[model samples]
Target: MAPIERRSGRKRALVNGEDIEKKNTLKRSLRQRTDTVKKEKPSTDKVNNNNINIDKKKVLESSSKENVEPPSLASNLPKALSCLNRVQPGIQGFIPHGLHSNNILYRLQHNAMGITRERSLRQAVVQSYSDQLANYRILTTASPFDRRVTAMQWHPTLPTTVAVGSKGGDLILWDFTKTEGITFMQGIGAGGSVTHLQFDTTDPSFIYTSSIDGKVSRQDFHGNNKTVFLNTMDWSYWYCSLDVNYRSNVLVSGDNLGNTVLMTRQGEKVWSHRLHKSKVTHCEFNKQCEWLLVTASTDKMVKMWDIRMVSGRKSALYELPHDRPINSAYFSPDCSRLLTTDQNSEIRVYGGPLWDKMERTIPHPHRFFQHITPIKASWHPIHELIVIGRYPDPQFPGYHHGENRTIDVFDANTGDMVCQMLDGSAKGIISLCQFNRDGSYLAAGMGLNTLIWTDVAKLTTQGALSVNKTISGIGLNPNRGSNTSQRRRNRRNNNDDEVDKLKKKLKTKTKTKTQTKTKTQTKSKSSRR
Candidate 1:
């Protein structure tokens, strides 16, 4: 075999010749496999549903030849090889892998549980607190001044006008009767802080502003006169608070010097009381008795005073003791209850003729979580619920990320939190909040901004939607309309006469004064020469 020679005359060993033959055979087998796969790939693309028509007659005829022995192969094959004879391979399902019995059912003599426990809890909520409120919305938070708003009060008869006193000592009156027709005006002074504002009950345009300059000026929008009544000499201390009693035609004002002065409607001092050792933070009159007054101070005492009993310090009726400085002391709308709040986040409700008996003390919803500052609580006009505004106490356990502040409603009687309205902007601390007489609107003063939450549903029913486009042309009632029109006509007549007479008188006086001044100047120049 080692001496073999090829017929082509090239010398080749028998071992090398056999190796070449085996290599050629392996290459032929690989080329055949690749050629067959290429052919099968194109045949798959040529497949069409219409060309493979399934005939029932063919299938029935083929069924009769089932007795024939199947062709032997490496594996068992489906007889017809249809698509239905195959299935998706998975771990478990209604049909088990290789026909195993995993999914099962039992009759159990007709007794059964309809739904699993996990599924039962996935149903709709039964106590839906979201449905209790109507179409409530925060219209806006407006801060017109450079500093935090200090004083705020709503117009007595009108829901549209809210008088806000800025820390700059200017009163900005916002008219939201028609938001598009809103207007504001600067009032009184930039002399000092306008600490408080109280609108007159009988007059829509008449409002009183207390300034830190020791001046309480009665500003009326009805006329051009801003200072109808200004008592500067009597009130030497900055006026901290002011309240008007329309029935008694009197005004009660508390000062930073702990002096509470009772003034008549004409700004005449009727009486004065100086018993508090600290500044009077708040003062409010009882709805039933205009003579009765409750003033809260930093002295930790809420003292009640009657203008009629203005004899001495003995005239002070009752003093409510508090653990911390009292922030607000207000009587309920019906005059049947009294509410007091302290800097320690304590709220107390009192009932009885003199509000001497304590009804309940509401728990702080924020608990021991510390707020950077405290806020006053507002009582619902017709219910036993009070709204307490709070921000997410950063001191809350595990608290790191701050959230939007919330105004929580709580039951005044049971001390349970009811609902909450989130301040989506996460604005600064809320300082003041109050409800209207009918409780249709809530005004919250947060930081330098005033946020008004209006009961749009209740307002719509009351024909607020029918308000005219004119800022002051809302016809709320026919009687009020007629009365206002008459008063306006009379005021116009008086103003016209006064302006004409005063203008003529002023012109004549100025002419005379200028002539005299000119003559005096000429003489002085001659003397100098």
Candidate 2:
């Protein structure tokens, strides 16, 4: 009986050992399956976390590379930027005006809230115009000359009429109102190129052309008759720049020999001054102040002269010196500021009343080379904004490695880049750009090709309101301001809101995914325990 019991106990022990082995094998198989699942599918929380980090890095990199300030960031962020920065920070509540707004403490405390009424009004107007900056579609393209286009101008009174002068001494008068387009085309230069073009102040039918051959020609509207208006006579000197004052019908021209000649509409020289040691690159008369004349020169100086106090080279009324040769100088629409572009990488703004001090210096790339025309900064006809052709430099802020050269618009007051205008039609460097009388149309000259852009919204609304009047060139509609401004504001706000909502949704989705993953892990661990 003992032997039988011992055998039964041994059998029982063997059965228990088999049960233990079976449990171990099941655990091993389950572990293997779990390992394979883990290998095939990572933990969602970790994966989602990695993806969020990657997305954020990509967003930051793209933003830095593009150099475009997203409206969400620009409008919502509290920035400690300079007071001169036109971008207002996202500050809540009313801010008191400070006596010294430029002080660091005031700038930190006010964040653009301490702006004066005049400055506020000016900025408001500039902002209103800035809102109209949509991508200007290429309205038209034309090859008006055989050689490079050096000068372009829109008729002061005729909205559709434009004149372009070429390096081959060729002139083309184009009227967008006509189907044939070319109203006049002529070669008015004897041996040199046409340097500048200007329209007569009182007569839209007459135009002025200056040539490197030392001749300024006046042509009738039809281009049938050309009269040699002003001949420098000394075949050595040539007119380089020309501008006419519409108020007084007084014309001003700069010559390569550093002469700034003021003339009457009758082609008689009022006075000539040796304004610079080098060639005069640009001469302009203030549209608002007829007697105020400004001249830029290759001698690295910009000088302002009041023609009323005219004398021989007896020092300019006010002079702004530069480190590099000045390419062009222009007065603001209100004649309260002067904008000058230099051959090197600098653009300067001189404040008005007394033009002695340089208000701001904006760094820009405009290296002068032989193949390209000198880049000249121009003023928006009605706003406190500046426009200039951008030289393609990898180091330039908005320039990409392989992108086409663009036209840059800047805020004259704040010295901030406002926007860039680019299109497929502008394949070459846009060396010249000009705004029409009311600033509704813009024309740019690229090599020999001419590109024109009209405000899309303005054109559309005008077409819808009075198609016949628009076609007939009646004028701008005065009643379209309020609704257009409101629409622009609404669109801008909607865009910002949409971008913000998308960002918020992404953050929420990540949070939800992480929370769900954590909860699932906790439940699985509890069940295992």
Q: Which candidate is the best by TM-score?
A: 2
* Model 1 RMSD vs true structure: 24.1
What is candidate 1's lDDT per residue for 1-529, written digit by digit as tens? 3545556567554446555554555445434533554454453343333433334343334433443222231011122222223454777637433222111232111124432232122111111222243334454445554445677787777765677776667566776555453445554445467778888777767778787777777766433676645455653558788888888888888887788888888878787878688889889889897778888998889878777876765667887888888777878777777888787557888885856788888755333224222366777766666777764555554445756567777665556565766534435566677767666677777655566776546446656443212234321121123334646876999999999999999999999999999999999999999
Residue-pair clashes per prediction, in order, are: 0, 0
TM-score between model 1 and native: 0.57
> What is the lDDT for 244 in model 1?
86
The most accurate candidate by lDDT is 2
- Evaluate all candidate structures by whole-model CA lDDT and list the values in order: 0.63, 0.71
- Poorly placed runs, candidate 2 (over 4 Å): 1-125, 188-190, 233-235, 246-249, 394-400, 456-529
- Provide TM-scores for the models: 0.57, 0.62
Clashing pairs in 2: none
